[model samples]
Target: MSAGSRVELYAAIRRDARAGMSGRELQRRHGVGWRTVQAALASAWPAQRAPYPPRASKLDPFKPVIDQILVVDLDTPRKQRHTITRIFNRLCAEHGMTDVSYPVVRAYVAQRRPEIRTEHGRTESAAFVPQTHLPGREAEVDFGEISVRLRGELVTLHLFSLRMSYSGKAVHRVSATGGQEAFFEGHVHAFKVLGGVPAGRIRYDNLKAAVAQVIGFSRQRVETDRWVAFRSHFNVDAFYCQPGISGAHEKGGVEGDIGRFRRNHLVPVPEVDSLRELNEFIDDYDRADDDRRIGHRVHTVGEAFAAERQLLKPLPVEPFETGLWMTPRVDRFAQITVRSNRCSVPSRFIGRQVRVLLHASDLAVYDGRTPVASHERLLTKGACRLELDHYLEALIRKPGALPGATALEQARAAGAFTTVHDAWWAAACKAHGDADGTRALVEVLLLHRHTPHEHVIAGITAALRAGALTADAVALEARRAAEPIDSAVPEADGHTAILTPDAAVVASLTHRRLTHLPADTRPPPTVTAYDQLLRQTTS
Candidate 1:
C-alpha cells in the first residue's frame, strides 16, 4: 500500500477506537490486520519496517581479484583497462571459478570502479565548485567547428564564441580559419559587440593560437608573442584553465553556449553566399537571443547585460590590425602562395615580391602600398583563385591561351564574363578571323576600368547590332549608352553633335547631324549650267 493510503487507514482506525471500539472490531471494520490496528492505536502512525540481515553473493569469493584489477586500472590508459567480462574470464581461467555469471561480476565492478577512482583522486566532481562572477569581469572564449552551405558548396567553418559569465550575453563570429588572425579578429569583434572588455580575466583553454606551451601541470603558460602583444594592446587579463578534459569545465558556460547557438540557429545548416552575409545573420540571431531567460533567472539576458555593460572596462581608442602580414614572391603563374593556397595578382607582379595582408576571409596584395589585387580567401589547399582582368595584358598577346586559361573559367563561373561576351566573341571571330577577334574582345574587356558594367554591356550590345567589331566602335557605343536618350546637342555645320556628358568615357564628341541632314535631290548640283557657259565661250 502507498504511504498516503496507510496514513489514511491509521487515521480511520484511531477515529473508530475513539468511539470505544475493540481492536478486533476495528480490524474487521477497517479490513486491516490486528497488528496494524494495535500499532495504529498505539502511535496513530505506521511503524517503521525491520531491516534484513546481510546476505552473500555468488561473486563474493572473487571480490579481492576484482578490487586488485580495478586498483591497477586506475593507472592504466582508459582504453587498455580491464572490462567486467575480462575480469569474469580471468577468474574462470586462473582462479578456476566457473559457475560465475557475467551479471554478478558487472554489478560489483560497476559499483566498485568509481569507488576505486575516488579513492585515487580521479573523480572530476571532487574538484568541481560553484563559482560566482563579478559583473562584466569574467568571460569565456571557445571555438567550435560548424558546417554551412556556401553557394551550394558544403564547407566547414570555425565559429569563435565569447560568452559573458554574469549576464550570459554572447558574441559570436564565423571565420574561415582557426588561426591567430581569426583568433585576434574574433576578440576585436566580440569586444566591440559587448561594448567593452572583461575587467578581471577571461577564461580560455590552451589553444595553440594563444598558449605556446603549458608549463608542467600548473596554470602557468608560455603565451605566444602575438597573443601577448594583443593582450597588452587591449589591456586584457587572461586566465587559462588546467589542460585537457579537466580544463573543459573551467569555461563550461561558453562550451554550452556553442552547442545552444548551433542548435537554435544553425541546426538547419544555413546557406549563404559569403561570410559577411552569414555574420550579419548571426548578429541578428544573437540580439534575438537576448530576449530569452537563462535557467530560472529573474532577469532576461538583455536586462542583465544592461546593468553589466557599465561595469566593463572601456575599449581602446586605437584599433588593432588583426590581419597577418606576409611577403610572398609572385610565381611564374602570376599568383602568390598563402598557407598552401594561391591568389592571383597582376601579371606585372610576376617575378616580384609582393606584400600580402591575409585576413580570416580575404587577402589584399600590395606592391609597396599600392594595392595591386585582392581576393576572397581560398578554403581548399593547393586551390587557385584567379581574376581574368589580372592577366589581360598577356592574354591579349596570346589570345589562343584565353580559351584554356583558368582565369577565364573562373570568370565565367563567377558570372563576370557573360553570354553576351561569348556571343560577341563568336561574331567577332566570324567577321575578323579568330586571333584578331579575341584581341578586340580583350580591348573591350579593358574598358570596364573606365566605364560602368551596365554601360559596357549596353555598348557591347550596340556594337553587335551595328556590326562594329572594333574596340574603338565599342567604346563609342558604350559612351553613347551612358548618355540620356531625350537629350540633344546644338546643331552645327549641318550636323547634329551628340556629345557624351562624361567626356572621360571616350576620346572626343561624335557628330550625328550629317546623317540627319536631307539628301540634295533638286539637280544633284550638276555642272550643266557651267557646261553651257563653256559652250558659249567655245562658239
Candidate 2:
C-alpha cells in the first residue's frame, strides 16, 4: 500500500479501537488481516518496510565482459561501436553464457555505456544563461535552407536572415548560393533594408565567410581578411559564437527567427519566375511581419523598430559594392566565360577585353566604359546565356545560321521572339524565299533597338491583319501605334490662316487652349456674298 493509504487505515483503526471494536471485527470492517489491524491501531505513522539484501542476477557474471567490450568500443568509430544486441550475441557465442537473457544483457549495457563515455572525457548536458538585449544594440545573422520554385523548377536556395536583438525585427533575402560573395551581399541588403547598421556588435557562428579558423578552446578566432575589410568599411564590430554546438545559444534569436519565418511565409513553397521575383516576395513578407509581437512585449515589432532605428549607426554615404570584378576576353563566339558559364556580349566586342562584374544573382559586361551586355548570372557550371540580338548581325550575314542558332533558341525561350514575330516571319518566308525572309526578320529585330516592343508587336499585328508581309509596313504601323495622342496645339493661334468650314470646326476645337480670346461679338463674315461676287466676275 502507499504511505497515504496506510496512514489513513491506521487512523481509521485507531478510531474504531477507541470505540471498543474487537480486533477481528476491525479486520472484517476494513478488509485487512488481524495482524495488520492490530499494527495499525498501535502505531501513529505507517510501518516502514525493511530493506532487501542484495541478490545475484544472470547479468552479474557477464558484467565484466560487457564493461571490457564497451571500453574497447570507446576507441573505435561510433558507427562500429558495441550495441546491446552485439553484446548479447557475444555473451552467448564466445563467452558460452547461455543462461543470460537478451533483456538482462541489454539493460546492463545501457547503464554502462554512459560510464564509458564519462571515463573517456565526454562533456555532460549543456546549459545556457538567459540574456536581455538593449534596443538597437545588437543583431544575429544566419543562413537557412529553403526550397523555392524558380522558372517552373524546384530549387533549394539559401535564405540569409538577420534579427535584431531587441525589437525582434528581421530582414530576409534569398541567394543563389551560400558562398562568400552571397554572404557579403546578404549583409549589404540587410543593412540597407533595416536603414542602418547596429552600433553594437552583431553575433555570428563560425560561417566560413567570416571565420578562417577557430583558436583552441578559448573561443578566439582568426577572421578572413575580406570579412575584416567588410566590417571595417561599415564601422561595425562583430562577435562570433564559440566554434560549434556550444555557440548556438549566443545567436538564438536569429536561429528561432529563421524557423518562424519558414513556417509562416515559406510553407507553401513560393513560386516565381526569377530570383528577383522571389526576393521581391521575401521583401513583402518582411514588411508584413512588422505587425507581429515578440513574446510578452507591449509593442509590435514595427513599433519597437521605430524607436530602435534612431539608435543605430548612420548608413554610409555610398553603398558598398557587393560583387566581384574580372576582366575576361570576348571569345570568337562573342561570349565571355564567367565561373565556367558562358554569357554572350555584343558581336562588336568579340576578340576584345571586357570587364565582367559578377553579382550574387546577375552579371554585367562592360566594354571599356560602356556596358555591352547584362544577364541573369547562371549558378550552374557550363550553362550558357545567349541573346538573339547579340547574333543578329552575324545571322544577317550568314542567313542559313538563323534557324538553328543557339541565340535563336534562347530568344524563343526568353519570349523575345514572340509568336507574332514568328507568324510574320512565316508569311515573309512564303512571300520571299527562306534566306530572304530570315534576313528580313533580322532587319525587323534590329528595329527593336529604336522602337518599343509593344508598339512593334501592335504594328506587326496590324500588318499581319492587312496582309502586308514587308518590314516597312510593320514599321509604319508600329510607329503609328507608338505616336502619342495629339492633346494640345504646338503653335500659338498663328497657324490656321484659312477659315474654311472644316478649318472653323478645328478652330472651335482649339478654343480650349485659346480661352484668352474674346467671344466673336461682331457679325460672322459674309463668305457667301463674296463667293457670289467672284461668280459674277468670272461670268
Candidate 3:
C-alpha cells in the first residue's frame, strides 16, 4: 500500500480496535489489505479517542472579507495586490483573525481569482464565405515568432511568410523586427522568389503592419500611410481577416506550412554567426520548399509557379525601396536622426526642408526631385551619426560655403570616412606624400566609379610594379588597359624570288673563241689525190 493508504489503513485499524471490531471487519470497512491493517497495528503514534472528520478551512470565516478586497482592488496588478500570505498576516494583525493558515488563504484566493474577469469588449466572429480560390489567384500572409541564436544571443525573430492558396507555394524570411519595414522587405523578397507578383488579392491578419484598426470583418479603419503607399506601389489589394480568428480552415494552407516549417526546419533553433549567413540558409530552404510537390499535383511548386508566372503583374520600373519615410529637423550640425543613426544633408539644407527615404538596405537623402546622398541603412536604432566621407567631395568643392552640409561633420566624426578609402589612402600615402598620395588614391577610387574595385586594385598594383605610381600615370595605364584590342592578324602577299639555270656549252670553249672553218675543211682531201696520181704513173 502507498504511504497515504497505509496511513488510512492505520487509522481504520485503530478505529476498529477501539470499537472491539475484528481485522476482517476493519479490512471490509477500509478496503485495505490485511497485511496493511496488521502492520498498522504493530506500532506507531497513539490512537486518538475517536475518529475525526476532515477539518473545515480556517479561512472560511474570512471569505467575505477577501472577496471585498478583490472587488476594491481589481484594478491593481496581481503581484502588487494582497497575496495569500499578505492577507493572512493582515488578518492576524488588523482583523484579530488567527485561525486561518497559509494553505486556507491560498485556496480561498484561488477560488476568488477566476471570479475577477476584466472584459475589454466582446469581438464578433466574422462571417466568411468559402470561396473556391483559383490557382495563382490568392495568397495568404502572416508572421510567426521564432527564436534564433544570432551572434550567440537568443533573439526573438519575426518570420514573415506568404503562401499561395492554390499551389501551396510559400516564401519565408527572418526579420529582426516585425514592423512596417520588415513587412515591406518580406514582400519584396517574396516577390523575387515567386519571380513575379501574384495576380490576386492578398490576405493578411489584422496586424499593425498591414492594418491600422479593425473596423469590421469587411472594413478596417484607415490603413497606415506606409501600407497605403506600399499598396499603391505594388498595385495590389489587401484584405484583412477578423481578429483572433486565425485557424487552419481560414488560412489552412499557410497555417500548416508555418507549423511544418517550425517543426522541421526551425526546431533546434538555428545558430548563425551573421545575418547574411542566416539569410543565405533561408534562401536554400525556400528553394527546396518551392521544388517540393503538393497534394496530388504531379508538378512541383516550382513547376506550378512556372505555369502561373505569366499571370502575375509586371513589376514596376523602379522597385519599391523598403523603408519608413520621415521628416526630421536638421540639427545645427545639418544632420537628421533616424532610429538613432544620424544622416547629414548639405549645410545648405540646414533649416531647409529635405526628404529622408529610409530603406532596409539603404538610406536615401533627397532635396526636391534631385537625390543628394545615399548611405547603407543602419540596423540598430540610436543616434546613427552621419559620416563625412559621404559628403566630403561635395564639402571640399564648396569649402567654407557650408554647401548646407548639415550632417557632414557628424558624418565625418562618425568614422564613416575613416574606412571609406582608408586602405587606398594608406597605400597611396605610403608610396607618395599625403597630398599627392591622397589625390592619386582619389583617382584610383574614381576608377571604381567606372570599373569594378577588383579591376581598379589590379590596375593600381600593375601600375606600381611598372614604376607608374603617380595617380595620373596609374589612371592613364588603367584606361589604356581597359580598351579593347584587335585580336586578328593581317593577311600577307604570295610573291617569292627565283634563280635561273646556266648552260654547259661554255665549258667546252677555251678562254678565247677560235675561228671555225667552213663545211669542207683542209688536210684529208690533198693526201688522197696525191696517192691516186702516183699509182696511175707506175702502171
The estimated TM-scores of all candidates read: 0.80, 0.75, 0.48
Model 2 regions lying over 4 Å from their true place: 1-30, 33-126, 212-222, 295-300, 303-307, 483-539
List the candidates ranked by TM-score, beginning with the highest.
1, 2, 3
Q: Give the per-residue lDDT digits (tens) of candidate 1, residues 388-506.
A: 99999998889998888999999999888999899899999999999999999999999987799889999999899889988998898898789655335445466766656553322
Question: After TM-score superposition, what is the CA distance of residue 409 in candidate 1 from its true location, in Å?
Answer: 1.4
Instruction: Give per-candidate clash totals.
Output: 2, 0, 21
Using TM-score as the measure, which candidate wins? Answer: 1
Selected candidate, larger lDDT, 2 vs 3: 2
Please state every model's RMSD to the true fold in angstroms. Answer: 9.9, 8.9, 21.1
Instruction: Name the weakest run of 10 consecutive residues (lDDT summed) in model 3.
Output: 503-512
Candidate 1 vs 3: which has more TM-score: 1
lDDT of 3 at 93: 88
Top candidate on lDDT is 1
**Per-residue lDDT of 282 in model 2:** 92
